[model samples]
Target: MTLSPLVFAALIFALVVSISYAVLVRWLPDPGKERLAQLTPGRGSDHSTLWSRLQKRLLAWLLWLSPWTAAMSGGDEETPSALRVRFGHAAWRSPVALQIYFTCKTLLTLVLPLIAWALVEISPWHPQGLQRFLPLLVGAAVGYYLPDWILSILVSRRQRALLHAFPDALDLLRVCVQAGLGLDAAIERVGREIRQARPELSDEFALTGMALRAGSSRAQALRQLSVRIGLKDINALVSMLIQADRFGTSVSESLQVHSDALRTQRRLRAEEAAAKLPVKLLIPLIFCVFPSLLTVLLGPVVVTLARQLIKPVG
Candidate 1:
């Protein structure tokens, strides 16, 4: 029942490849994430999705595997408010998201190093001590930070979607306000109106309206919205709304001004990105494309010149 070195190496390669593919899939932002969040009710564990169920099972297994891992798995400690707020910005406010995230991190952090160590033990290199542990350490580092990287990516994408939706929302709010609905009513109406088109932004507005109805002050609720979103535009909009309300200024006019400003900023961002495109492309243009083109066009010429300059003794 012993495996040969070749078999062991093959197993290691297969394990690494499979794990990498799984991580790639796991890291991708789910398109149906918001929809799932909306439909899946109840607390902590979201039994509605396959991924969530998998996370729950994995967590249970981790807690059973090594009791000490509880701290690493986030099972023993209370979820941090900062992490919760960060997830909210990523449109993953459910308790299940926190569970899934920490579970994945713990699983990968523990699994990867073990796999790396097994490979190193069988590896032919045979580094004495410190060098042998290098790969394992590298694997551990990547595993620990992978979830954080994925979360940031999710936050960026959700922010982009919300940013695009903001101007339309401002217009709707302006219309609602000018039509004499109070600012609170306007938000609720806009939330309902945009639910079909911009569901994520709509959800935030709906929550803000609910908070206001639940006796939270206008400033407090608006600030909460800005916090959850963690977007500068929303933060500015919240501050503007609060100031307009506090000073008894016309809300409609403020909304109109802010809406125009958002549009202008969006255009400027596009132009700035376009301006940077050539500079960004230069690296690949020089390193990747030029080398290949030079090889194709000048490789034969160089070979010919070398042959001519150093003729073989005949």
Candidate 2:
């Protein structure tokens, strides 16, 4: 029996999906190994899989396709460094990720306009003259900046997560220090303990702990942590810790004070947001709710008046 076109198409799609899934499974790293490597530092090397190598090559080709654009936007010393810093702030530390991001931006910027133009040509409402070019231009502009917008959103979310977890991490650190753990040990313990609750903060702390273990000074590790996080609270905490270490002050006391201050600031922020709720709602209330309400209440009256006037004229 012959299959219908729809059935044939569905079978083809299912085959494609299954093949893709199989390839992904083969190429992906073993999650168990990855987790083990993360938990136990220096035990195993993170070797690149075949899939990762292929992906890197593809991204390189994409970059090579638009050398001028990549050079102008990301290849320069200043631009690459800034992009790396931005990636770190967003918790994405891979340099190759930046290359991939630029590659995607370039492809989108070129491809979207072509796709838009093709769509316009095939559309039933065949646009004429300026309309034909307008969508293409708009699509190109949007595609060019889409990566930047996505990166900004990622950075904001990461920063917000860091902010939300900061006070809790500080409290944990203070407790650990008070219980006689060294600062480095306390950081490691905090990272391990907070892994489930705040993965972002835990990762930062884990990196700082690794730096400390790798023979970096406390001040240097803390400073690098501040740079990676790019948060005022973390910077101030790093400075405070450095000062406390230099002056032979108690680490626990400093941490406790900072944690309390952070909590107060967080509360104030919450209150400020609550206070702005009414103002933010005002626009929706006026434009949406008020219009619907007025239509409902006055619509019948207007209809009745119109009927009465029409009857008199008749």
Candidate 3:
């Protein structure tokens, strides 16, 4: 149960950081708290229920460099950055998400090299010349991009889920629209009906419904939905919906057509994946399966030839 000096030192460092955070939160004025309170959305700020929020406020304030860094970079400060949009697509629509991401990226890039260096120092293995800094540099690079990698994974998983669940949503929406429901009502009803079956798409539909209810125009809400989902098929569906809504077209018929198109897209995606199967298996076939097969097939022939040649020589 004994901790190594390295582990002990890490633990002490963490403890000191935590204590510093606690003291800083206790005394220093918090702008993060003020910002959160402004956007509190009518939640009562009772101290008992706000302990977790209180804890995060100071941390967000302490991680203020991210926004400043973004500001220093050249771009429209008003419009959301591409990184922010990616985070939104990943279903992390929180105001503090980008801030937290930047903070983690900065910390990891700075801390991992030091950690690697410490380990190198404590360990018996000594890396000479450029080899000494290689691990540290690699660690720093990995740490810096680690958050991006995670966000990409989350976005990919969420998008895959959305794609698989989308055709179901479309079918339901078409059914609802044909069943004497208005488009908005159809969407809301579809959202409710599909909630149990496909919650990812269900949530998107539900949010779109909410946005419509909250005074956003149909086109705007649908556009936002398409952007957030970031699937070609979904974007197409959004365009179709917007056009249908604008031109006073038959939504039921449009839904039917779009459903067919989306299904075709899904099938094509499946077929494309199937087509690539051999390509994906190529490496394993060559390195693993083919070698074993050659060994089994050629071993006896090679041994027989060797025995004949050796017998003749004797």
Candidate 4:
């Protein structure tokens, strides 16, 4: 019922920070104008509109120091960064937006753990300090990478959704191709048709079409498509397309086969996940569900037995 000193302190700190952030945002420059300044690494503006500038600076500082930010910028040795694939062409054209993202992430990393620690400490079932701190540490780590993890998850889910929709897209493309459209035109038409339902795949296909229109070879466009989407299925599809283009094969037949193969792979993946459910459930059953069941079933017996034994002893 009553808040602890620590909880009160955190609440106060949060309120002050919120108010400060509001005041900062009220009078700031559009980070878009200063985006290059932030990216270029120079003596940045001392002030943007005033409030927004501080927010931007705070964000820049956070981005400058965050583990996630640092990790994002680093290159993978053999495999190119998936982040680059996903976001390489995204218009992160606003410095303020970038800073805001980092700031939010940093606050999540810090505040969630503190709130978690407070909740754990105050709980009637509060475990030992070691046990409690373990959760806090886990919460902190989860919170820190949470955004990137969510982004990765969204990308994964989007890819799955696209894979699911790929058959329809492919069928449409085949129709277009059969109806006298060029390969590129067929892809463009299919991309447009599926834009709403399979934005992830549609966007990549559109971009591929754009690349081809811009005079990139079909192979190059397909390769770029594979790079942008960053999925094994898409990569395989791209390779197939490239090979078909190179060896004078039937694009429609090749696509039809690939679509069927993708659907099969998706089905197999679903089965695999379903098979994993029992293994995943075992831990919770053992650690959580069983204990509660044991308490309910044996608790009264234990109490009665204890009373019987204690009475005889007395």
Candidate 5:
């Protein structure tokens, strides 16, 4: 018997996919050549390699498929500056990383629906037209939004780490300044000393130092730090520093005051979280723990009462 139209279509699709995979595997350069090219230092040597040319062509194809990738990647006037700042806060500083992110989004958006459709088609259940397309829509939507969710998680985690490190960093800076070091020296010293305890904060401080050393004004560097951190507290601190620098105020005294304030704020946050713990636990207790407890406590008693009440009449 001849195959149905749907079956014929599926067989053709599978053949195409198989052929594409075979071609790619056979044509792509070996991993050894790629590594050799990497080891060869000069651009001329690397670019001349077969693997490098293949890699470039592959990258070009991906870029063509996702032409909007570079535009959304970063620094586009149309793209929100806040998003670029968020990427910095998340420690994804490479310009190419944004392109890779958008490329992933594009690939997922295109690929997931096809996969969903193929799976639905091959299943014994044989979903109807609308039902078959439903998974495709869902897959596309999820694929599109997944990157944003992942980025948000990264930003939140980094912000929390920086928050935890800030007060200690402030204390270190204060001590260094009090010992007669200049502001830049105090910052650099704090960065080095706090590296073990708070790597994220140390990195931020180190970057700020680098910017300062590269001849950027202190105010400009501090502003950049605030942008990188994307924190209100850092913004406030940057503003305070700029003001102090303008007026020639004692840096040590300012740091000391800020450090104390941060400590107080941290303490208050801890206390607030502690106070909310019981409330947070209430739902779990009612839904999970209480049911188990009630069953354990009343189960035997209910059983005995049931037996007594159901006694047979003579």
Candidate 6:
């Protein structure tokens, strides 16, 4: 088959575009480096410690890749060392890792368009040569940022999963405390008990426990937990815990009450969604189902009427 000029041009353009995308990907920051930098202690006894050395190597490799990352990650604003230290606790490990892991997914936005183009090119149904450029352009644009968009979706899903498990975690904590464990012991117990069912929450709880054991205050650990999840429910729970601690209230009672409230709120949310189901269904019924029903029910009558009316007119 003789190759057309337009097809030849598109193939060349795709090659150049793919190369540019690869360069852009190489220039993006490695999330693992940012994570390590945030988690590393600023100054310590051993600057040559194994983890510290590893972090340094990672940072060096990351910085080597993109000179822009240093600029993008942070600017000249001088945050206190103490304040920067707190950021590690606030960052949700999953979301950051999520963004890094799926950054390459953006390339998929090109797949459908490329496939369609190839199909049209080979098949007898091929359109005029000039029309082929449109799909390729749209595909490239969509594919270029698909990864970033997918990462956001993943973050949302992870957040929802955390929220779903939170009430159970609170209930477990309440039970542990009611069984005579102290607040710290109760938190540890809850973390251990819910490890399988609510691993994310369990991990956060365990981290809080670790921080507490490492000499941080209970309030500080709880605050960190709230920040890490970045969830309103976690914030409310932390606020309640803080108040209970300050006011000498029963911790178990406080947890139990919060758990009950969370459960109630979840139930109410489910009911609200169920109530909206009919409204949500209406559009589909009008556009799809209703039309199909009318076609099926009235189709024969219309055909018969057309035949009778036409014979009389003829």
lDDT of each: 0.84, 0.85, 0.81, 0.73, 0.83, 0.71
Alpha-carbon shift of residue 184 in model 4 (angstroms): 1.3
Candidate 3 ranges beyond 4 A from true positions: 1-80, 122-125, 293-314
Using lDDT as the measure, name the better of candidate 5 and candidate 6: 5
Q: Measured by TM-score, how close is model 1 to the native structure? A: 0.75
lDDT of 4 by residue, 34-142 (tens): 7756776764655554656676677667766655544433423533544445443342324344444455667787888998777666554457747868867877888
Residue-wise C-alpha lDDT for candidate 3, range 223-300, written one tens digit per residue = 989988888888888899899999999888888888887788889999999999999999999999999999999999
Candidate ordering by lDDT (highest first): 2, 1, 5, 3, 4, 6
Per-candidate count of clashing residue pairs (backbone under 3 Å): 0, 0, 0, 4, 0, 1
TM-score of each: 0.75, 0.76, 0.71, 0.58, 0.74, 0.62
What tens digits encode model 1's per-residue C-alpha lDDT throughout 1-314?
Answer: 77766787788789989999998686544657646666766532233366666767876764455544446545526656788888889888665565567667877888899988877776664677688789789889999999999999999999999998899899999999999999999999999999989999999999999999999999999999999999888889899999999999999999999999998998999999999999999999999999999999999999999999998999
What is candidate 2's CA lDDT for residue 164? Answer: 82
Candidate 4 displacement at residue 6 in angstroms: 11
Give the residue spans of candidate 4 off by over 4 A.
1-83, 89-155, 304-314
Clashing pairs in 2: none
Q: What lDDT would candidate 3 get against the real structure?
A: 0.81
lDDT of 5 by residue, 1-314 (tens): 76676787688789989999998786666656656767777633443466667877876776676566665554466667677777898999876565667888888888888887886676554667677679899989988999899999999999988987898898888888888898898889899988767989999999999999999999999999999999898788889999999999977788778878878888998999999999999999999999999999999999999999999889
User: Candidate 2, residues 182-255: lDDT per residue as tens digits?
Assistant: 98999999999999889999999999999999999999999999999888988899999999999999999899
Which of 1 and 4 is ahead in TM-score? 1
lDDT of 2 at 192: 99
Best model number under TM-score: 2
Worst 10 residues of 3 by lDDT: 67-76
Estimate the TM-score for candidate 4: 0.58
